[model samples]
Target: MKNNRNRQVVLKSRPADIPQAHDFEIVESDVPDLLDGQILVQNVFLSVEPAMRGWVSNVANYSEPVRIGEVMRSFAAGEVLQSSHSDFKPGDKVMGMFGWQEFAVVGPAAVTRKVQEDDLPLSLSLGVTGLNGITAYFGLLDIGRPRPGDTVVVSTAAGAVGSAAGQIAKLSGCRTVGIAGGSAKVAQCRELFGYDEAYDYKSDNLDLALGKACPRGIDLYFDNTGGVISDTVLRHLAVGARVVICGTASFPTWDPWPNGPRAERHLLVKRARMEGFVIFDYASRYEEAVSRLSQWIRDGRLRYSEDIQNGIECAPAAIAGLYRGENTGKRLIRIR
Candidate 1:
């Protein structure tokens, strides 16, 4: 078993709803041999993102769906165990699409970045200092441009992306309001994440809660979950409001296209602008975002939380936990 024990979680079948543990099979295989330009990386942490739900779904999406029997796609950070590439050497830390596996045989082209850990933790490459922060940076600043004193609202405000987006909006001089699922997360949003106001969307009267939180109506909205929560937010949008469609975490599938209230009339009356953004579109400018995020970290103007789970065995349930609101912040699998 030691000789052929590269344990990995592979998709056993397409999930009819949200993917569950039964849909994956963890199997052992021989560790891959190194090629001329490839390196062997032993993963340390695997990111549990909401986007993974869409990846495993049997429906159309912005990217190709993960085929059955393939290693589940994920972002991970790890150390190079062996290398045959000129750009990388053993002991170097890196982050990329390394999937839900213990060890990955990756070429130089597959490496997203060779991490430079000056005073930062390596796990952050998969969290705050990585895609989560980058998504918040561009999506809020570029699309949902919150002006000074403007009331900016964010859905899923305690999750990774939403937390960062709310904090960024607060730092930019906006009156930030966060909408989370429960009382615990709502408190975390206001106390820990620096949101000026927060409300529990699961409350009996969410419209009243939102109205009380944002008495001026919402000027900018960083929308992460697009369902009834968003439907309510749309009703209170200030004239010329800008909405950033970041994710639809509340929707399980889009095959039949889940129906909701129409937006044309709201946009027409409010003259609101809604735009969609994908982080990969700004890949060329990652350094720019990272620089600002790092500075914010250094200045103590930014803070983040991570809900880490140990062992590769816990990988299958991580995504489901994210959907169920079981995590308080960023969800990750620490594969030792």
Candidate 2:
């Protein structure tokens, strides 16, 4: 009977600045009986993303915060074990916001899209060919609009979304420059993803590195860590540049309004446009992006990395690890 129990993580408290283990509680309960129109899923991989920080915070954001005492919101890829839904059957693979749990009983609305077995690992559905890929594809191409010879700079370049965005920009004929937090990530951006240039924002001189790497100035800035790193990048924007504000990793809290150098004058002088992106905005077209991302991988034009933690017990600290920059690529918790 213990084997039939479902283990899950729930939010104990909304985080003040950064999430800690105490903020989450792992609970085990009897697996609920399947309901009409519901499918039972045995979650395999749970995604840990930066956006989770905002989801658990009290700060205003694009989406509603994960209410306290609810199962922590997360994206997961899993296999169907039982189904009352017409389309899903036992053994079918699926991906969706299945939360941080070993098993979930959900309806069709909870499943984002059905996944097919392919040469790529199913975990890729949570990273390169999933949300990260879709986010990078539309966020960079549709918003940043990089052109041939354009200097495209991506902050947090070693991260899942940032790495994919940089690679896509490179494939589009743009000169890609990645800004990462450490020497290891910088090396990864350059060696693994083939960024034209990569810099360790922690160790490298910000001004000097930008000057050397972007001699013509940045034509497209994919700003992920939108604190000091983005502030410095703004100083190098080319005329008519497009800045895609994909994330704000460095800012711990937005409620108090962290102060930094304003980009108003810079934007005006450079005649550039800056915009924010939410992956859900492009939800209807995720399949299209995933197909192309898959093709890119098959043709060897794209690559991805995953840092998998092997237990549901890791859920509490998984997102904290992301907040600390402990993850090199996509962070996933393997909870089979």
Candidate 3:
């Protein structure tokens, strides 16, 4: 019999707003015998991203909700320890849709892509070159479409997608203005994330702060936080601006899925454009983004950050941290 050798975090409860520790139950399980073409992988890094929040919700989205009592849904990076699959071997590093667990028995279909070095860390394969990177690429280039010399504004600008979006805007020859939750994150936006200007949205006078930072009037708005902050940005948009709706982290809850930026009048006034995007729409083009983003990192034009927490036991709090704006950049849990 195959030995039981996995540690996992199971969803204990459906969260009302932000998930809490009580929502997960960490437990050990027996591993089943390998099927015809399966591989056992020791998960090394697991992505604890804001996108997980949308997946946890019962609301409509491109991705399905994580069913109650299931292992919390997640993306993970791992090393193969045993393989019955012809394509995989021990020690091969892989990235896949593994969940909140330390070990996974994946068939060929579960493996998404193999990790290879191209002047970047393996962990970043879970960040900039993976789902997060693809989201930034499509959301900014296709939806936010900034023009040269235009001023682009990004909310949650120190986080994974926001950081990548701002840098891409700058590379497109636009001035980038970033707004994030706190002083530390705002600092990272300009110095680390390569934004042209940045502001702390926590400032009481956020509207005034945005007005000052975006003196040229916003040309393209890559909105990761949709709410009053996004509302204020819409008022500052230049004529013919584009807004990409990627997130609403600024809101407290999603049961009602709080509304954001009733800027229809602003869009009408400025002759601007607004659209909602889910990154999975461009999954086929993910390789194109990975190649370009990896090059940028090699050329010293791009950067990434991770707030890694240890163990599956911390998964619930780690995931919840994103909603509280407690994480500095990309958040992940080290499962092994």
Candidate 4:
């Protein structure tokens, strides 16, 4: 038996649809003792993000794929339980690329940040105020470039990244619209996320709803899911509109790459610009975004929520939940 010390989630199988519980297995293992610049962290919270599906898919992407039977990759926040690294210390709370496991042995190079436990919720360091928040800032403003009085629409608007993108667009003085999976999420978008308009993709005809809300036409569209949703938005783009492509959650099938409705005619008619961005490329500008978002959060200008599950044993389930739209806000599994 592989009798090590960490409780980790390993790939048990691949899925044809939303990942099921059986797709992963829990096992115990121990990391080797820390070397000169390494540290062992007892995970405090494991993040369950939508992009995890892409990471596990068979198709090649910007990064290498996670191999079958390997520990599932995740972004997590934890405490330094043991350390030999010059920068980290015992009792420090940090966020990094540590995957789904109770104990993570990571070197200094992978650590994204060390956080403080103050009035702000610590778990959020892994969510809205962390990567998701930063992603919304850069992906929406730097890429989508919503102009004042212009209309902006976001898919998966009630999700972590989508919700933040909508709110930030609203703050930028643009008319904000949202497309979410259910009525509950739609309500959250109009009320909680402060979207000027929101529609349930499950109930309302997306074309009709988007047409109604964006009568003036979409000036900026931030896409988290592609396929029909993107096609619908493409038909409504105003002249010179900017579209930021983030992810494609709608396509569950793992083909070689994404191909969808031909959008060239829409682009030509609107004279629009559409670009895809991987947030990791903006790593150097992360600090500036975090500082701005933190201020907005502190000034009662931001409203954020969370769906947190307890224990590392539930970590695999948490990651699978994002694909099925099981989480409300930022999905997290508490692992202390």
> Could you tell me the TM-score of candidate 2?
0.98
Decide which is better by lDDT, 2 or 3.
Answer: 2
lDDT per residue as tens, model 4, 1-336: 124578889878876555667888898776667777888887888888877776776666787767788888888888898888888899888888888888888898778888763567778888788899889999998999888999999999998889889989988998999999988999999889899999988789989888888887899999998899899889999999999998888887656456778989999999999999998999888778888888889988877879988877776666567777778788888875
- Give lDDT per model, in order: 0.89, 0.91, 0.83, 0.84
- lDDT per residue for candidate 2 within 147-220, as digits (tens), equals 99899999989899999999999899999999998888989999999998899888889889899888889999
With a 3 Å backbone cut-off (N, CA, C), the pairs that clash in candidate 4 are: 4-29, 4-30, 5-29, 5-30, 6-29
Candidate 1, residues 130-248, lDDT tens digits: the string is 99999999999988887998999999999899999999999989999899999999999989998988888887488987888777788999999999999999999999999999999
For residue 331, what is the lDDT in candidate 2? 96
TM-score per model over all chains: 0.97, 0.98, 0.94, 0.94
lDDT of 1 at 275: 96
- In lDDT terms, how accurate is model 1? 0.89
Which run of 10 residues does model 4 get worst, by summed lDDT?
Answer: 1-10
By lDDT rank, best first, the candidates go 2, 1, 4, 3
Model 2 alpha-carbon drift over 4 Å, by segment = 1-3
TM-score for candidate 3, please give it. 0.94
Candidate 4 Cα errors over 4 Å, as ranges: 1-4, 16-18, 256-260
lDDT of 4: 0.84
